[model samples]
Target: MRWVALTAVAPVAWGANYYVTHEFLPPDSPFYGAALRALPAGLVLLGLCRQRPRGAWWWRSAVLGLLNVSVFFVLVYAASQLLPTSIASTVMAVSPLAMMLIAWTLVAERPGIAHLAGAAIGLGGVCLTLLTGTAGVSMPGVLASVAAMLVSSFGHILTKRWNAGTDVLASTAWQLTAGGLFLLLVAAAVEGPPPSLSTSALLAFGYVTLVATALAFAAWFIGLRYLPAGTVGLVGLLNPVTGVLLGTAVAGEVLTVQQLCGLALVLAGVVLGQPTRAGRRGGSRTPLQPAPDKSAAREFSTRNPL
Candidate 1:
């Protein structure tokens, strides 16, 4: 449950990010936007972890970085620019089922019936929340959002499969840093120069980098370390829930009674899919271990004194 709560932070921050990016960030230069967000956040986390990738982690970091950070961030930015907050987040709501399927295939984590039901109910709620004929839909935006979902599902599950006994912070930092560097090179080549930032844009990037990217990914990876992928995915239903409420509160969008019901259903799905005590004991096949070095072990203990 503690892990569930921590995991919930990622989706909530991401939900708010759709609104922030759509409203404040530059719309045109997604590569620069993604690079800026990933690099700064990666550097901050790397500063804390003070560890570099080892052996397979070097290539693993690059692969996960490309899938999870570079391409994922760019596509998400494009989708946020092209779609409304609620709609964009609702599209992402499908990730729970996707993650479950990918985890089953990639990591042998079979989905429980409860998880399947929760996914169905949660997805139905997301539909009810967004299928109202009020917002205009973009096919390209939908494609981008769907692409982001698939890429992230595969990347995250691959992380789970490969990250057995690895330090979450250090590995996450490596992925982010590698991805950020990749994005910077690509952005330089294609986008000519970085976009100018207004004060609002700077603040927006700060929030996106620190809260949404760094804190959110850390919390999310922590959850993946401790919980089943299906459970973590169900918790992610909060992304759309937060997006809808944020839209109503901040964007002056009206919250229909149907959306309220959808929110309830989403919450219900999340709660329903929580791992029981027995499940938690048995479901997590991999046990966490030290970071394969005395210095990293000391740093991890120093930083996480819990």
Candidate 2:
């Protein structure tokens, strides 16, 4: 419960990322924007953690970093450029479904029918809330967003696989540093000259680095450690909800009746996906890993028992 609550913080920050990027950040240099968001936060975190990846983890850290942070951020930012935040986010709503399949395959979790139903409902609700009846979407942007969701799903599973009993902070720091460096080189090569920042842009970048990348990723790893992959993915639908609410509250946009109803459905979907205790007599807990599984624990003991 505590980890779930902590993980929920990431969505709101991610919601703010869309708004800040669209409203304030440079549109043309997504690579640079991505690099800026990642590298600084990573360096700061690495400084604090003071732990280095050893042996196989060095490559594993790099792979996870590229999949989760560097490449994912660039793709997401590019999608935000071409698609409405709503459209991009709605596309991301499918993550729960994707994670369900991946988690079942990887971790051997058998979430009941309710979990699948919840994913479908949450995805539909996201569509209803954010679609806005737009007929045309940029094909490239849509593809990028969907690809982003897919890669991130895999990344989440990988995180769970490698995470086991590792220090969330140190692991996150390693991935960030590796991904940050990779993106920095790409940003330098393709992005050309860096854009000058106004005060607001600097502040927004600061917020992105601190809240969105640093704090959010930390909480995300914590959530992955505690919750099942599918549940964490389901909770991700809240990102779109936060984006929608932020639009209405901060951007002065008004919500329609359909959108309100859709929000309700999204909430219901999240609840439905959660594990519920069966009857008291011979009561059995539904599939949920409140902590690492046995294999994961063994891996931790063998790899790093310090």
The most accurate candidate by TM-score is 1
> lDDT tens string, model 2, 29-94?
898899899888888877877767765678889999999998899998888777766566667878
Every model's TM-score: 0.92, 0.88
Error of 2 at 235 (Å): 1.1
Residues 156-256 of candidate 1 have per-residue lDDT tens digits of 99888776656788888989999999999999999997899999999999999999999999999888877888899999999998888888899887888
Deviating ranges (above 4 Å) for candidate 1 = 280-306
Error of 2 at 138 (Å): 3.4
Best by lDDT: 1
Candidate 1 clash figure, as a count: 0
Residue 130, candidate 2: alpha-carbon lDDT? 61
Give lDDT for model 1: 0.87
